[model samples]
Target: MMEYFYPEHLKKMFTNRKRELKDLEYTRDSLDKGTLRNISFFGLRRIGKSLLIKEFMYRNPGNIYINIEEIASSPEFFSLRYIGYIAYWLNENGDALPDDYMEINALIKKCTEMNIKALTDAVTKLNLEFSKEKRDHNFLLGLAFTLPEKICREKNKKIMLFLDEFQALAVLKKSPQVLNPFALFRSAIQNQSGTSYVLAGSQITKMRSILEDHKEPLFLQFNVLNIEPFTREDTYELCSKILPGQDTDIFESIYKYSYGHPFHTTSVCERVKEYSEKCELEITNELISQAFLVEVLSKEGNINKFCRYLYDISLEKARGYGILKAILTVLAEKEGTTITEIARGIKRSPQATKKYLMWLEEVDLITKYEKTYFYKDPVFRTWLAYYEKGIELGIMPKREMLKNLLSNLEEKYLRTSSELGRAKEFETKVKLEKKLGIELKNYMSKDGQIEIDLAGKKDALIYLVEIKWKNKSSDYKDIENFLKKTEKSEFSDKEKKLFFISKSGFTSSALKLAKSNNVTVLDRNLEAIEAVN
Candidate 1:
C-alpha cells in the first residue's frame, strides 16, 4: 500500500500551477503598490484551491495560513482562533518577519499554544472593550481581523492571511438576523492600510452568495480567481513524475479520463500505478480504464468520503434529491440537453426541471452553456452512466454480464467522445468561415439521408465541408464518396468545391485524392487549408 500524502509528501507531489502562482504574485505586487482590489479565489472541490494556498505559503515565508474548516467545528461557535496561527508564525519567523505593529494581545499571543476557548478567556481577562453591543460574530471577528491589520500598519508590511474554506463563515450562521462575520471581514480590511487576504472556498453557492450575489454582503467586492486544469504539457510533466518511460498513449488516456481536473488526474494515475505494482500489468488502455473504475468505485475511507461530498453537494442538501437524481442521470446520459429535454426524460415539467438545474448549476454540479447543460465533471458523469446502465440490464442475460458491461462502458465512452467531436465541429465551422472569408450554414438534405457539417455559397462557387473526428487519419474513400454523392444529387450542374476537415490528419491516399480532385484538407483549426489554396 502506498503511504498517504503528508505535508512533506505533498510539497514533492505538487504540480506546476503557473497561472495560479502568477495570480498570487500579481496580488502581492498590487498590494505593495497599493492597487490590489480583490482577494478571493474559487474553484471546484479538489481542483486544488487549498493546495495552491499551501504552496504559496510554502514558497513565501512570513505568511499565516488557517483553515476555516477547523474553526467551523469549535464549540465556542465563532472566535479569534486564527490569531494563534499568526502568533505562531510571528514567533517562528521573528525579525525575519515584520515587527508587531501594535501590542500583541496577551490572550492572542498565547493563541500559538492554546485552544480558542482559552484565547477567548484571555480576551475576557484583559477586559477589552471590543463589543458592548454583543460578543457575537461581529465582536469576535473585530478582534481577530484587527491583529493582522495592526501588524501590517505600524511596520509598513503586508501580512498575507490565507483563509482556506472561507465559505465556512457563511455556513457558520447562527441565525438569519445575525450580522455576518464575513461582512465584518470586508469592512475591516476594505479600508485597512497594511493587510492582504486570500480567501479560498469550494462551496460554490455559498461562496458566490458571499462574494458575487448582488444582495449578499461581500457582493462583487472580492476579486475572484479561478484555477483551471493543468494544460497538456503540464499534465505530461505530472505523469512523468509518477512513472517515466510510459507510452504517450498512456498519458493521453489519463488526460481523457481526467479531462484536466487536477485531483482526478492524480487519483487515477496513482491508482493505475498501484494496479501495475500489484498485478504486474502493463499500462494499457484497459489498465487505465479499470484503475479509474476502482478509484471511483472504491469504498476506501477517503475515496468514499470524497464521493459522498460530491453526492451531497450535487444534491445540494436533498432539495428534491430523487427528482434531482433523475435530472442528473439525464444530464449524465445525454450531454448538452436543455432543461426541457431533461424534463421530458424524467417526466417532469420544464419549469420545475429548470429550477432544479439552477440549483445544480449554483452548486457547481453542472454548467449551462447557452441553451444546454453538461456535467462539470466528466468522471462523475461516467460513474452515473455505469450505475444507470447496470440497473437497466437486470443482472444481464446469465453468463454474459461481464461482456455486456464492457460493451456498455464502450458505448458511454463513444457518447462522451462524440461530445468533443460536436464541439470541435462547431468551433471549426466558425474558424473556417472567419479565416477563409465565407459564410457557412448547417446543411441537411430535405430527405435527411445526407448532410453536410457546414455548407455555404460564395458568389459563383458553392462550398461543402465535412469535419471528421477519429483516432485514425481520415482516408480518401470517405471524402470521395461524399463528393460523388453531392455532385450527382444536388450540385451536378453547379460549380462546386469541397473541403474536408479532420482532427487526425488525412492519410496519404486521402491527401492525394483530395489534391487531384480539387478538394482542400484542413485541421481542426482550419489552418492547413490556407497553404492548400
Candidate 2:
C-alpha cells in the first residue's frame, strides 16, 4: 500500500492547477445563473479528471460527487440505490427529514420495484408531474432529478452534482428494459432548475458514442473541457518543491521524461527519490537511467499501466486487434513515420493502416502532424520502442524487459534526443522572443540548406540563437562555425550578438572564447553566463 507522490501527508498537496480551478469556479457561477452550456467534459484516463472534479466539488459547497463506474453495470445503481446515496450524503450534517417523509419513502420503494405499470401508477398516486409523458421510462432518471431539486429547495441552497466516468452508464442502454437511458436522464434533469450537473468519462471513443451519437440521447448535450499537461514553468516549480537541491538539468530531465504528465511526473519523481536515497547516490543522468529501469521497466510500473490502457482501448476501436497491434508496433518501432511507411512495416496497405492511425488519433493516444503521426508522450513512445524490441528478441517475463535496454540505449537515445532538441529549439524561439520583447524572423536559403533556430534583432544588434538539449555542452567548435557565417559582408554593419542556449551549458573554453567575441552563453539555468564586458 505504498502511496504515489511523496507520502500520505502530502497526498492533497495539489500542484499548479489554477487555470482549471478558475474554470470550474466560472462554471459554478454560470450554473448559478443558468448560463453554463457544457455539462459533460471528456479526458484521457488518469489525466486528473476525477481529481479535478472532486476538488471542484469540495470547493463548491453542497456539491454531490459520484464515480458512476463503481455501480454502473449493477442493478444497485438502477434501484433506489442513488436515492440512498444522496440521503446518506445529506445526513453528513446529522439532520432529520421533512414531514412528508413517509410518503417520499413509499414512492422511493415503488420506484425501486420497477414494474412499468406499477411505477406509472405510483407516479399518478403521488400526483407527481411528468417530465416527459411519464411512460415506462428510466427508473433512475426521475429519482436522480428529484433528489437534486428537493435538496436545492429544502436546504435553501443551490447544488452541483459531479458524475465521473459517466460513460459506464452507457452499458445500461444495451438492456431491453431501459432503452436509451441517457436521453431519459437528459429529458428529466434538463428541466430541473437550481442545480448544476457535470458528467465526465475516460474512454474517448465510448464517451463519444454516448455523448456524440446523433441518434443517442445525450448527443452534444454536455460541454467539453480537456485537461492538458502542466506548462514547463509549472512543472519546474513542482520539481523544485519535490526535489530540493536538484539542479536545473535534473528538473529538465524530470519534465522531459514525464512530458508534463502529472501522474507520470509525480510517479517518476517519487521513484527517483526512493532509489537515489536507497542507493546513497545523488540524482543524476546515470541515476535517472537506473531509476527508469528499476521502477518503470518492471511489469507493474506506470509505463506498463499506460501501455496497457492504450492497448485495451485500441483493441476496442480498431477493426482487428492484430491490425491495431501492428500499427502500434510500427509506430513504436520507429516514430514520426507516415501511413505508407507504417503500412509497409506491417506489410499492410496505406489505406488499411490509415484506419488504425485515425482510430489512435481519435483516442488521443497519438497525434498527427502534417503527414507524420507520433505518440503524444515521447517517453511512452520510447518505452514502446524498447517494449517491441524485447518482444521481438523473445525476451520472456516482465522483469526481463530491460535485458536488452543497454544494447538499444545509445542509438535510440541519439534519435530521440535529437528530435527533442529540434522541438525544444522551436519552443525556445517563442520563450526568447517573449523574454526579449521581440519576434524573431525565420528564413531559409535559396538552396534550402541553411536554417536558423531563431534570427532576430535587438536595437542595432543581430541575435542569432541556438538551443541544444543534450547531455554534452555546446563547445567552442560550435561557436566557431557561427563566427565563420558572420564573417560574410551580410552582417558587417550590425554587431553579432550570439545567444547559445544549452540544457547542459557550454564548455569552459567555449565560454572563454564566446566572452571575447561578444557571445552570450545561456546555461541550463536559463540565465546568461555573463562573460565580463
Candidate 3:
C-alpha cells in the first residue's frame, strides 16, 4: 500500500514524444482525407504502444480502439465483437443505423448457418479445426466492417479504429477460417473517405510482420514509428516537476538504471518515495545505495519479477549474458580496459565476446566503443552487479541475496576512501590549475611503466601527483622507485612538479627524496596541506 514518486497518469505522463505523436496524427489526418488506410504502431512490451494509442484516441473522440488480445478467438469472432462494440457506441450516441445492415448480416450468415457448413468451409479453405469459435468470429468481422461505413454515413463524422495487440488476432489465420479480416478491413477503410485504421501491437516481430513486411496482407499499410526514451534533460525535468528537492543524482541514477524507459523509471521512483519516507537523511548516495541495493532487491521486493523476464530469454543467450555481465563487472572496477583485455577477463574468445556484445547492444543494454563494451545503463549495471546473477545462478537464497548485496555495499563503501582521495587530489589540481593559469591532463601510460594519477600544466610548468593509500612513512622505497621510474621516462619540455599523496605523513627519507627530486608530497588525508607555490 506504499506509493513512490511515479507520475499519476502512469504511462500517460510520456512527454517529448511530439515527433511520434505528430506522425501518428498525420497518418490519422491523411486517413480522414481518405489518403492513408493502414497504420501500425509497433514496439517491445511496455514501450508505450498501448498508452500512446489510448492518448491519441482521447484527442480524437470519434475514434474507436479495440484490444484485440482480449477479444481474439477466430476471424469471425474478432469481427463480431468489434461490430458489437460499434453498435453499442452508435446506439448510446443515438446515431442512425446503416440501411443494409441486414443484407451484410445475411451475406455472413451463409458462411456459418450451421455446424456442418462452418466445418465444411473451414476444411476446404483453412484445413483448420471445425469450431463454433471460428464461425462466430468470421461472421462478426463481416458484420463489423459493414457498420463502419454505416456509422460514417449516419453521423456524418470520420471514424478511426485502433486494433490493439493485433498480432494475437492475426494468429486465427491458423484456424479453419483463415480469417484475414485485417486485410479486408484495410480494403474497406482505404480511402473510404471517413474510416481510418490504426493497428498497434507490443510484440515487435509480430506487429512488424503484420504491417511493415511486404508479404503480409496489411504490409506497408501504415507509417512505422518507434517510441524512444526521454533524454536526460527531459527525465530530469520530469523528476524535478514531480519530486521537488530530490537530488539530481537520484534522477540521473534512475535514467541510467531505467535507460529512460518511462515505466522502469516510474517503477523505481515509486519505491524511491517509500525509501525516502522511511529514512531520516535527505536522499544521498548512501540512501540510494541502501534503497536500491537493500530495499528493492530484497526478498520482499520484485527481484523475482526481474527473474521471470530474464527466464524468457534463451538459455544460450542467458549464458552469454552472464559472460557479458562478468566483463562489465571487471570494467566497472578497472575502467578503460580494452576489448582484448575484456576477452581475457571474461575468458571468452574475441569472436564469442563480439557476439554477446552485439546482443547487448541490440537490446540497448550496453554500448561498445571500437571493441570495448560498457553497460549503457548504469542502473542496469547496478542491478546486474548486485541482484541478477546471484538470483539467477542460485548463488544465495532470497535472504542471503540481501546479505551478500549489503556485504558488497560495505566493501564498496570502504573502497571509496581510496578512490575519493584520488578524486579529491584531481579536484585540488583543478583549483591549482586556476591559480597557476595552466591546464592539467591525466594519462594512463602503457607498458605499465609510467603512470600519472593527475597532472596539470601552465606555460612551461607541469604538476604531477601520484596517489597512494598507504602511510607515507612506510612507503619510502616505493616513492624512490616511483620517482626513479618517472625520471627514466621520456619527456619533451616542461618543468615537473612531482607530488606524493598518502594517508600517512611522509617519512624524512621520502620528503628528502621529494625535496631533492623537486617533487612535492601532498598527503590526501591531510587536505589542509596547500600547494607549495
Candidate 4:
C-alpha cells in the first residue's frame, strides 16, 4: 500500500481558510447575538467543505452533526427517516430526545402506521393544517436547536448543529407535503434562540440548485461562503515541505500541471515523495516530466471521459466537430493561418467554416489567437485527427503541397547522395543554408497558389518543406500541377532551394526528375526536422 503524503502547510485544512473562518465566525457571533441561524458553504468537489464543518464541530463539542446525504437514501424516506436517524443519534449520544423530537417522531410514525385510506385522509388534513398556519417543521428543526440548549444547560456552555450536505434533504421538496415540512423547519431555524447551523456540500451544482435558486424551497434564506482553491503561493508553501531544496522552477512546474487544483497538486506531491526515496536527483524539469508522465498521464480515463461527451453529441454535430478538429489541428500546428486558407483546406467556404469555429469556441474546447483566429488544444486536435477521419479532408490545405514539394526536390537534387559517392569527378553545390530559415519575396503567380517553398533572402532565408505522413508514393500529376502554378504565378526569380519530405520514399521517376531539376528529395526518416528554430 502506498502511503499518501498529506502536507501540513497551507493545505486545504480549515485553519488555512481565513475568509471562510471569518465568515463562519461572523455567523457564530450573530448566533450568539440571537440574530443569525442558517449559513451555506459551496465549492467544487474535494475542496474541504466537509472538513471545515468537522473542524467547526471539533472546536464546539456541544454540536449535533447530521449529513443529509448519508441519512436520506431515497425520496420515500422523508420526515420519518430523518426522525428515525435523529432518534438513533439522540439515543446513542446521551438519552432520549426532547419533547419536540419525540412529538415529531411519533406523529410521523403514526402517519406511517396508518392504512392507505387513513394515510391519505391524514395527509389531506396535514396539508390543510400546514397551508393555514404553516406545518410544525419548526418542531423537527427546533429539535436541533433544543439539543444545543439542553447541552448548554447541562454543561453551562453553548452548542452548535453542523449539517453537512444539507442540500440532499431539499430533494424531499419535490413532494408538496415534504416541502411544507421544510417551511416549518426553516421557521424553526429562523427563530432558534441558541443553536446555529453550518450547512455544506461538495456538489456545487446541486447545492446551488436547491438553496440558491429562488424558485426552490430554500432561497435567499441563508448566507453563503464559497471556498476557493489555494493560490500559487500557498501551493508553493505546501510543496516546499516535501521538496526541501527544490527551486522555484519546480513550483512553477507543479502549478502548470495542477493548475492550482488542490487535489491534483497534492496527489502529484505524494507521488514525488515516493519517487525521491530511490532517486537522488532534486526536483527538476526531467523529474517533473517523469512524474507527470508516470503518475498523471498514465491515467488515461480522465481525458477519455471528456471526449466521450463529444462522442455522445448528434452525428451531424460530431462530423462538424471532426471538420472543426482537423482545421484546428492544422491551425494549431502552424500556429495561425488565414481564415480563407483554412476554409479552402477544409473544402468549405469561409462562412461555413466560421459556424463550426463559433460552436467550438462557445464550448471552450478551443480558443482563438486574439486578433488572428487560429485553433489550438493538442488533445482536442489529436482526438479529431484520429477519431474523425472523414472530416480531416477539409482541415488539410496543403494536402498535395507535401507531395509537390517532394517531387520538385527529387527532380532538383535527387542524385546529391549518389554524386557524393562519385566525389572523385563531382563538385557539390548542395549548400546546407541555415538548417532552418524563413524566405520572403519568393514569387507566387496565382492569387490562391504558386508560393515557393524556400528562398534565400538577406533578412531571413525561408526553408519551407512539405510534410507527408500517409502516402508512400507521389503522383506525377501533383508535380505537373505545381510546375504549372510556378510558371503562371508572378513570384520573385530569386535563388531558392526546394525540399520535399515524405513518410515513404519518393517514386523512382519522381526522384530522378527531381535530381535533374535540382530539387532535394528527403525520405521519411529525415533527421532533426525541427533543427531550425
Where's the lowest-lDDT run of ten residues in candidate 4? 420-429
Hey, what RMSD does candidate 3 come out at? 17.4
lDDT of each: 0.68, 0.63, 0.56, 0.50
Give candidate 1's error at residue 156 in angstroms. 3.4
lDDT for position 344 in model 4: 81
Q: Whose lDDT is greatest here?
A: 1
- Evaluate residue 4 in candidate 1 and report its C-alpha lDDT on the 0 to 100 scale: 20
Q: Is candidate 3 or candidate 4 better by lDDT?
A: 3
lDDT of 1 by residue, 1-533 (tens): 01121266777778877657767877777778887555788888888888887777777767777678866632133443555456656555322322331234544445445343433453563235343444444555566666677666555677677888888876556654445666777777777756678889887667877788777778876778777777654565677678677865677677776776777778878877876887687888777766665565455423334765788755757668899888888887788988788999999899998888888888888899989998877777766666555533221123354455556666764344334454455556667898769998656554445667678888989888888877788887887887776776576688988888989888787888888887888886676653232
Q: Could you arrange the candidates by TM-score from highest to lowest?
A: 1, 2, 3, 4
- Writing each residue's lDDT as its tens digit, candidate 2 over 293-343 gives 544456656666676566675567456778777777778767789888998
Residues 256-364, model 3: lDDT tens digits: 5455666556565655666666644466654454445533355544533553354344233455556766765675554445677777888888778777666555554
Ranking by lDDT: 1, 2, 3, 4
- Alpha-carbon RMSD, each predicted model: 13.5, 12.2, 17.4, 23.9
TM-score of 2: 0.65
Summarize candidate 4's per-residue lDDT along 1-533 as a digit string, tens digits.
00111223423433345456656666677767766567888765555676666555444433466767765543333443444433433333323333333243454554455333323333344434445554554333334333444443443444456677776665655555444444545655554456666778765566776677776667887778887766655566556666666766686567555545565566666667666776554666656644533342233323333444443542244556578656665564444556777788788898988887766554445556754563333333333433443322121124264354334323432222221111111111122233443332223322324554333444433333433444457544444444454445443254555566555556666666656655566655544222111
- For candidate 2, the 10 contiguous residues with the lowest summed lDDT are 93-102
